[model samples]
Target: MSFAEPSRIEPDDNQSRGIALAILLLPLTLPLFLFLCLFVFLPVGLFAFLFSFTGELLFYLSMWNDGRTLTRRRLRRRLAAGETGTLIIEYPMLAQGRTHAWWTPDDISTLAPLPIPDRSSDEYQDAVLDLMEQDQSHPWDAWCWQEYTSTSQGKASLLRVWNGKKYQEWLARHYPSIPIVETTSEIVRQLEIEAQQKSHQPQP
Candidate 1:
């Protein structure tokens, strides 16, 4: 089955705040290291030199001006391969300087059955909801989709998002009876099986 086309939301300029911070800190490392080397122990000097170079490189890599495009391309490939579902949410942690794993649909589970109240359509609400809203039944409010943790074994976790309203609407308009699951891991797993089977099939 084909998956919904993934759209990469461009991080707003405000999101560049992290990059700005990284850039500002990048230049200060040398002077700080020199000062430390001059006033501190020799071991401190060696460690300072090594850590300063590594830190600057990490900052540049994580906050490069082109990093956003790299992220978007990776996401597009995953989407095209039917690798994401409604429950998948990309977590970008700029403060920590890392992109968390893309959460998959199958990873979501319900803590209990509870209705997700409609937060939209309210008169006084903001133009956008920054984080995802979940059905109260979801076990965890935020889960790393697609990534399975040792603690998550056997136990189901909750998956929630905008509830795939747009994707469902598009599918309904195109193929009214299409069966789209909340997550994509099962589909991808099945696809892998099918591919292996086809590869092993005898040639006519």
Candidate 2:
């Protein structure tokens, strides 16, 4: 949370004109926006997502951006009520389905989820690591660049490689002091136990 005073963008002094303009525009733009979202986007998106990885990224990115919007909205409401303190939000990492705890000040700042490519995809190595869209410096601590795969039982599993290309530069640049701690042995043990328990269960 930034202690700096929030910049106020004063609305038009003539409220009636603004209201009239909105009234005029709503009938024209609302339907068009809805049309694009429903007919054009949804219809095409359903098939595109199944056929192309690029489409999958676009769809998920939109959802992540929407999440950021909600986060910002909640932060604004809190700030408006004279709340000030460190704000920590827990979220799943963009690169993988794992917990990521964000510890930062109680400002309205938001981190948009990164568009990380799937580890098995050809573009994984070429994936851009830029965070310029958020208009803030990279918060390296907020990122978890692990890969995930489905286990035999359809459960999610995390795979963090110490020398994974996607995260090598990110680790060195942001988290120099924090030693790498993510490992798979514990997860492997957990999965093995789960398998054994399943095997012991009576068959239907």
Candidate 2 off by > 4 Å: 1-13, 52-94, 97-204
For each candidate, the alpha-carbon lDDT, in order, equals 0.38, 0.38
RMSD each, Å: 24.4, 21.8
Clashing residue pairs, backbone N/CA/C < 3 A, model 1: 103-145, 104-145, 104-146, 105-183, 108-157, 109-157, 109-158, 111-137
Q: lDDT tens digits, residues 24-63, model 1?
A: 8988988888877787877787897778566545533543
Per-residue C-alpha lDDT of model 2 across residues 1-204, encoded as one tens digit per residue: 669889998877799798999999999999999999999999898876566555434534543444422233453465467544322222222244332222123222233244422333444322223332332222222232111111222111121222233333343464443222221122333445666899999999
Clashes of each: 8, 3
Looking at model 2, residue 30 earns an lDDT score of 93
Indicate which candidate wins on TM-score: 2
Candidate 2, lDDT over the whole model: 0.38
Q: What is the TM-score of each candidate against the true structure?
A: 0.22, 0.23
